[model samples]
Target chain A: MPFTAPPLFPGDLFEGAARLAASAEGRLSAVSEAPARAAVLDALWEEAAALGWPAVMVPEAQEGAGGTLEDLVAILDGAGRAALPLPLAAACGVVPAMLPAEAGGVVLPFVASGEWRVAPAFAELMRDPRSPAAAAATEGGVLRLSGSVIGMEAPPGATHTLLHAPVDGASGLILLPLDEGGPGLRRFERLDGRPSLDVLLDGVTLPGTALLARGEAVARAAASARALGTLLVMVEAVAAMGALVGQTIEYLSTRVQFGETLSRFQVLRHGTVDLYTRHEAARALVVSLVTAAAETSVAELDARTLHLAKLHVGRAAREVAEGAIQLHGGMGLTDELPASRLTKRLLCVEFDYGDGAVHAALAA
Target chain B: MDAAGTDYAAFRAEVREFCLTRCPADIRALVARGGKLGRDAWSRWQRILFDHGWGAPNWPREYGGTGWDLRQRHIFDETLAESDCPPQYHHGLRHLGPVLIEYGTEEQKRRFLPGILDGSVWWCQGYSEPGAGSDLASLKTRAVREGDKYVVDGQKTWTSHAQEADMMYTLVRTSQEAKKQQGITLLLIPLDSPGISIRPIRTIDNWQHVNEVFLDGVRVPAENRVGEEGQGWSYGKFLLHHERLAGANVAPLLRQLARTRRLIEEGATEGEEGRRRALEHRLLLAEAEITGVRALGHAALEATLRREPLGNTAAVIKLTSANLMQRLDEIALDATGHRLVSRFRPVDGNAPPEGMEWLQNYLYGRVRTIYGGSDEVQKNLLARTLFGH
Candidate 1:
């Protein structure tokens, strides 16, 4: 139920979402802190890729689901609701959500057969904000790529960086392969516990087939793709926090104190109420933004509304997690309970794409 | 931008035209401006809706209601709210009307349903006692059975609009031999009956709308009782179910959201610096609320279409809706500069005195989370329902 007034999308695209969610749930609980986190993530990815879930956002004329972003929103929501925190959105929408129909053919083989694991790197350029330093030069039909690709926070286990470069003064993407020694590449722990990479692409050559989009369309593609990636993480965070809120309330009800349940206390109950209210509200706004972004350009969507949703959700995730910890007393501080793990994720996800302060500043 | 299209769009237009033209200008102006909308205004608006056969859409068609589906009713509410028409006072129309249609005898239906629709009778609920708000089953209001009358005594507190209500559908202790819930029975008692006295309770805003209803040996006909004896508990829960579902409707709040936006646009500042901070908070709250309503509404509708019990989901809606109402009011306070009062006293400076209006609206909105089911009560219900308490 993506908060749009109309039906989210064709029903068939989501019929198996519940099944996917159940499998993820089973796999997640069975793994238990999952000594192999990246392996577990890949396992879930393989399961979804088996279902062509990755191609749902690709236009159908290109031999994909060719469905709208709304279809992917449902799958993400289901995964989120079940606490299945796989990067389904990145797989389904990140690269393809903003790609032109012509480029859909290029992305088709990678998506349909799971041949390439592409992750987008849409970070701020150090010197010039309008264009990245990753400039491409073409002479006599020979293409060369140089400059740095900063802030490519591609998660662990990704094979390629979906790089948006300035070629002939236009924003177009080239799917750059990550090779051995990772020339000019520095990878580190992301703020959200994932792996982030920064690369300096000094004089690299690529076939023209690597061009995802060209001309002014690249600007639209780049902007929408970045927005899509942010939207996915933000919406997923909302779902995860919502699950946490439910878990916290359930914990309070059963966790007895002073000869009664903790929920019996006015202060804690009111705290939960406040947390719950903000969570629902933030989720609603995010849904609207999803709807708007699908219909119009990402830049055309209401900026203030988008910022408000991000800021509220980020703040709410912290508030609910911290409050849940406080109410659980000793157990909350310990890793024995899921709250400890979830709270960390909630705290870290605030800085995933950007934090509340970033959103608030933009909103202002 | 077009919101709803095809049939829904056309229906929305029809409703907009009907509510805009038929609802009186004075009442619309009063509601749009925001206030306590005294008894006369409420009754007039309800009567206007009743005349158009649009009042009490939740009631069955046989009982003079429009028999609209839940979504249709929701759209109607949205349209009326967007038009700034006074809300159809819900005491009788939303709360008790459905209970009567479901549990009332033919005589009871004929006797009570007309007034609920036509505004000839104003009704107030009498369930909350001084000590039995969240734990309402512990109510102590007593009704002793006589040959054809029941001698009722005890006090009902927090009865909204009780001073103006022609009647009160009350819950009274019918049999002390059973459990707290089973011993209670609902009795429809006229407000003007002998031994019944209503004391007005002025809220924080200095408005006298709710009342402390005290009854001393008030005699009520046996025929006035709804359903069977010792069943008031069930009927009370049923009424609450109605109230909670109605609370889920985001229609009225949408009106306030639009009004807040209009106010912000009208008071455009050079930098919008300070104003942006204040308005952003309001928009955040409002957007969350609208989306929550949509999400919850969809969930609730799915449950209904599948013929499953709603089972305390309504409590979720009521809680969030109340918080949003209060949040919106707070924003209104900031937007109108009503929060800038000196010594905690609101001082009005402009004509139309919009700041005072915001103050009153804020004060009135304070009861949102309290009355429908206080924030505490809703949590308890949710805890019990979800955790099997």
Candidate 2:
């Protein structure tokens, strides 16, 4: 019997995004390898924006597509499938969902049009309240931010950042511009080839208008954004894990050892099956989370579901990465094949947002 | 009922109510003690369901089933498990009844469907033999044609509940063909046939759930064969799918985890703060595993209901569920430390010790990955689907 499954949630949309990603495989590889990748990233974002993906979760009243949660997941799944090294999750999900609807006049247009490559840096504020990255002081309608948020996604090509900081004894959401190059900003590549930033702020000044929301409003937005981001990145990881399974299966089918194909070996075959199971388990978790998210708005996203998905998807990603690497043997250790790159991507996913240990604590 | 038209909440409430009120207390007690239901207990419950017009939840209505949709069937199973109902008859209702309904002759269905529906007859599967298990197609149980009868000679091991069953639906080699699976035939044989002997095997679980059935030239009528002579492999595969779908039942795993949590709380000491936290951490991880398993199992069940070919779904579910079951069992055993010895020792009466049941359950769960299809076997089959041999 053929191995079949119900398509990823919102099947047709997922398939459309999958086809787009599949067609962009050549450009994606080029973008991954290019030292000066800003142009490629821009071009890719422009295409994705043209497709209206960034506007998916935005309301139609705000000149956005007003798509469902599954639509966003579909785009993320596509990005993950092709190992697209862009901040699609931030631009498409977190940033859009985090910016409050009432504050749309100030930021919704940029988000809806994809004119601003915004990376959300609320993880530190949500997880570590005392962290310096989330420290800020507001005085007389002026905000002074002092601290650095390290390794935020898409910082190399990002035009702005949506973050949360402490303001007058409460959390405040802020959008800071990143267009001008400065010594405080250092760009680096993550293990998975995505651009990460070590952003250091030495008492940077922003108008009071930069504060999107304060107190209860900011806290709720941060929670909703974190939930949305966690789920999108997880969807990507699971999709990438699926890609790794395909890569490993293809390798095993032809890689000969001891006068027979590796796929012919019982041990190797069993290893592949284990990889597939992990992928399925992770996929299932993502699907359930997506379904739940689809039924509720971003603010009402279930924390328990988000935490559970994070914990299991993180674990599954690592196991699958390890299993895929082992099955590839000598080829697994080198960068000659996609296995190594996909392995790194999965490991990166395992640590993103919060690792298994973090989510396990939260879930408990 | 259609999923769109049905109020599942109301449906769930209805099933839960029925199960709570209709399931006998004695049967529930037996199941709660981790005791296997005997013929009488199984028949009693089956008859109750039959009388209530729910003899076969998965079967078509024409075949004496309630014809519940996938969601309704899932709700029913979950409700039954929650209510501590004894496991419904599976070998006959799930495995063979479907096979017969799909491939059996009218006369055969007339002869078998009623017994399975009312639970008057018990059926045990005879797929795994002494020499053939994971590689079932290589099974060596031979049957020679003799006029209107086929003389069978084989030793089938891991025949679960063979001693309690009245009949065996078995696979036997009928001719020597190039492909091992091609020559096989499925036959329904009466356990009381002259030359059939069943010996119980005591497993590590300290239970008599499985047996060894030795057939010394036992004769089955030609009409007993299901489908065409050489089409048994397909039928057997069909039955195996049903067998694996049973792994999708996540209620028991969740129930076991809940029990483990209770045991953890019961063993807590005021001063053992660090130990309590550690156990709680492990319990949290176990809950996550069950959650993932339940999610994946539900997805796979939906795919099955759509009649879609589940590529590695069945195998994946079986393998994952098996792994999760063993993990939960270990945690339960750990929670009740000294009671682990109960698995190795004998119990005096029905009510032995508080944790004795956990020890036995943990021991029995060891077979989850071994029986049906071993973990290795499932992986190999899945690999075949992905990469052609």
Candidate 3:
């Protein structure tokens, strides 16, 4: 039988996100310094936590909405369109999906190589500067582990860390209490001024039940979930880029240059048209990927689809972001404007899950 | 509705069986090797098909054809495409046969239609010239009146199968004083006429299927003109529509994609994640593109079958079909890796199959977007027809 797109939800996810963003348009447009931005991030996290978006994908038996991966992707895309400061896609969408049903009240803080520093309080300190170290794992069921898991963002009021470690020739994910983890736990400041910490597990022990069983299965599930979450993030980024390009076109239409509106220039119009074409191709490919993933049960096939989607969408997002900034002129680069923030966010998204080149090579 | 009612299940089965029995083993091998069958081989195959009365399925019943409807035509085309049959000389069957049936004099029909069906005379097109390609109306090929005959003298470039063709269906300038598009006439000229020269233009990839024909004062009887003088434009336009319609078939491309998938699957290591992923992605994209072509082609065929006038959007279907073929070639070559680079030579008076066949396909596939009409021309036609630009 021929395939078809699934039934669309009643409300347009994008319009709802746009409405929410419009309510806070002033704050979103405001240029805030580092300290104020950190405060904003904190407030945004609380708001997101209140919304229970992080638990949306978890089963209903475990306090989640019992939503499908499609639902989480839609929510994350909405968040992206709103340009929300919270890492809801990672912390909520990916984290909950990775953890077991009963593993609640534990926030999974995402970390990358450049986001935090590794302290020498752990049993074995190894750093791969090339790869992102999002979470740490303990060797045993050592709740009070004697090792330092560094380069982690300490989401406010988190009780434990979902640590990933290689134990007994098998990689496992273990939950470790943060406060009671001895001198191994030390806080560090990130470039974005977010609160991150290094937990040093100095031979601390814990109950054997603390270890998350089926480490390999959990790791694979986490990777897949993260990939799905990243897909949503990439989609959201494309939507934002589309909106930005539209706004730039409107601005250029009225902005006079040499007694004529900038939009009156043929070159400008053609350039925007070219941008629109790229955006359309990327959007179409992404939608196809989403549809394929929703329909296909084949894991490797789905991964291939996702890889192609990511490669095309990532490249298009980068182009759109750069074009928006260039078209906006010198004011675009300023901290006082939202364009620079959007540009930074887009750059971060381009490399968030995987770079276009990496994904293209993978797809290839 | 019943499932069998919507599907041509029975017709498909019959065609498949017929192909297995009637399709010659030598021809099948030649097609499989990607080589063109020689004249004798083609004659044998055509006679076999004619014996079954399936030689000219697209022709009207009055003209020695079965006169099947659109669905049956589609089934026949699809079966032939999926089979190992050699490339049927399209100039006779696709181009000239339709033109003669549509606008030919009674004598012209009687003289040429049988040769087309019996594969007695191989035909080639003489449309393009050095100065007139995409803007084809500006052809300078002159055919001046000389009593009961017209002397033809001009050059036609990009003439397919001309080197082996027995006859040339040419558009000659019959009136220079008339408007640019007016006063041209279509004529059937013998390719072996004195002062006629056929020279192969080696393509970038060195395929010899295409050539350039120079008409140096070749004489042709006035009776050879298929239609009224100055009506060549209309006939040519009709011929183009037929060509585009036939070219829209996607079965060959679909078969190529299936072959490519098998090749990639067989070559890829089980644990080679990246290469396997890439192949899988390419396959999906190809499938999607093919589906799009099928959807568009079906719509167009339905419209034509209903005897409804197809608006200029026909160009859109043609453009998409050509693009799909080009993309299929690109993917096939990529999948084949360096096997595509190997040298090829024709054996036993038949074209080589593996390396040179693919190289030729790659090279000729580029012209799909250029010939019949350049892609840009199609797009412009679509723009005008759909958007009134």
Candidate 4:
């Protein structure tokens, strides 16, 4: 059975969330036991596609599931708890939040069915000092774009990337397809075993439809997408921390030394309590972000809440990850147990979008 | 200011208007300098609130409060802090008034609620004795039954503002036959009662912020006892929860952070480039912390508004807010740069440096992590809950 977190806020999404969580938990269990990355990722993607996971935030008029951000949060939270090595949040959350229904109809279907996968590069655009400086020109119903973005955590096997670029003195959202071994594209491995891409787009050509949005619409959509993406990353990290906290407590209760279980030791118990409190604090930040979102339309995102959630949840994830690993003693150091896997996922989540230093600078 | 589907924007504007226009100028200035608003000035502010029907934001309407929800209360407090308005006298209003409503008898409520609402009476908490701080259940204060009164004898230490208060809600040992927590009783003792003596305790800031009160054969009527005999422990626990949540007050920290920003801007012209950058970085982290604490406070408020148990979330807020307060104070002092070495005799004729205020605030903020269940104590409480069956 999947580990279900209590609903942080009351909503109609819980029913759909319960069903999706169970499906995700079942598939992730199988993925965790797989011996290799390539086949495991493909199977995970196919299973998610069959389950219609990526279309959760798309509008129903676009032949998609048509769910709210709350629904997407529940799905990504489940993915985080399972430590599913996929860009579920990026594909399902940021993409839908960023695209209008007309554009969503065309792009989401390919993404939902696993024919194409996409990861968000908004954080890179925000943090990388080297501006994408992307300029776009319309050429007889086609678009030419050129920009360079660094530190993008491109999901393994991702077929496309979504980012914002300046076009004609206005911000434009661009969706670019990836060509295997393409020039100006540098691929590497991330700390969490995911693929990282540095794309140097030089006069790349695409259909006019690739300019998903421009001007004020692009600004609002980008803000909404960034806010949604940050919160979703927090949801996933907090979910993983929740799982780690439970696992650590159980380990403490079961592990024995010096004639007593580790839980019975006051020092150990207090250390666990610190970790639990940090996890709860992060969870509270996520809840407040959700509440703030509910109070206003997602397009008019609350900047302070968004910034606070990113900075606070990022640090909390790091502390909980290190503390959970430390508390498990010898077993925590090994990949056989879920502790290390969960820790690695948490560390990856912490650095994925702006990280602590980047966010701290923004906040400062 | 929108909350619970209601737009609090109008309410916020009304509060801001009152704080900016109606609050007494001297009183606002007093609060701005971090000066204590003694009984008279506090009563003047309370009268203003009472006249405006904003006397008690958290109390029930039946008790003459504004009947505002948690969001309104937060807005009122935040707006007041932003405007440099004197904070409410929370001892009787926030701490004792709620306990009376929850567990007090009709008579006790009738006698105490009005005074607290109208700001006529000042009350200090008497739960801590010299020997019974964090491990409070082991208190040696005794209260033996004597006809129509309870003869109370105890030494309560750290009685904040006791000298300016009229009554103290104390915890006394009523029985020896049960667990340490089970044998205590909460009683309200008038400070003027016979055989009660108070002594001021000077601190690091050389300010008499707290006092030591000795209750020797002080007679408090039996009617003053809250709830049943041997039930004070539970009531005390409830009050402590309220105290811990209240201790996470975010308004003053926000004000301090703004002040730090001003200090940083003022220092930028004189400081070296690298030093200014370093201070700005620290200020950034502090700003992030203030934001986090404010969000946590909102979460706790939402939880309370929903009538949900705050549980360990309260502890988390208390711990983090306390840390943030001290951290902000340090940043403010550091922003003062070379003026940091102005240590001198209090009686000296030399005028204090510009950093004197920050120095005093830094000294005063030391109690944030040490009071209202210290950081270690909160950690232990959280641990017990996690480990409990």
Residue A108: error of model 4 in Å?
A: 88
Model 2 TM = 0.52
Give lDDT: candidate 4, residue B59.
81
Question: Per-residue lDDT for A1-364 in model 4, tens only?
Answer: 1223465534544444444544544444444322344455566666677777776766667667877667777666665665666677777778777775456666777766567788776633432332444466777888776666654655556788877767666777778888754326654433343445566677677888888877887777777787777788888888888878888888878765534676887767887888889888888888777767767865566676677678788778867865775576534533446565577677555555555544556665
Using TM-score as the measure, name the better of candidate 1 and candidate 2.
2
Per-residue lDDT for B262-336 in model 1, tens only?
Answer: 766665554345555658766876877678776886687667656788876777777887777767775665454
* All candidates: DockQ: 0.01, 0.01, 0.01, 0.01
| Each model's backbone clash number | 4, 2, 19, 0
Recovery fraction of native interface contacts for candidate 3:
0.01
Docking class of 2: incorrect
Better of 2 and 4 by TM-score: 2
Where model 4 places Cα greater than 4 Å from the true spot, the runs are A1-364, B1-6, B241-249, B268-271, B306-308, B337-341, B348-355, B386-389
Error of 1 at B219 (Å): 1.6
Q: Write the per-residue lDDT of candidate 3 for residues B1-389, one digit (tens) a residue.
A: 13336457778788888888888787787776555455667777777777788778778898878766677778778787788675454578878898899989898999999988977778888987866766678888999989999999999987878888899999999998988889889999999999799987644334466677999999999999988988898998887667656655667777777766775676564334565666678778978978987877777777787788767546776787777777666555544422222212221233333344554565445666666666655665676766766
In order of appearance, the predictions have TM-scores of 0.51, 0.52, 0.51, 0.51
Candidate 2 - chain A - TM = 0.90
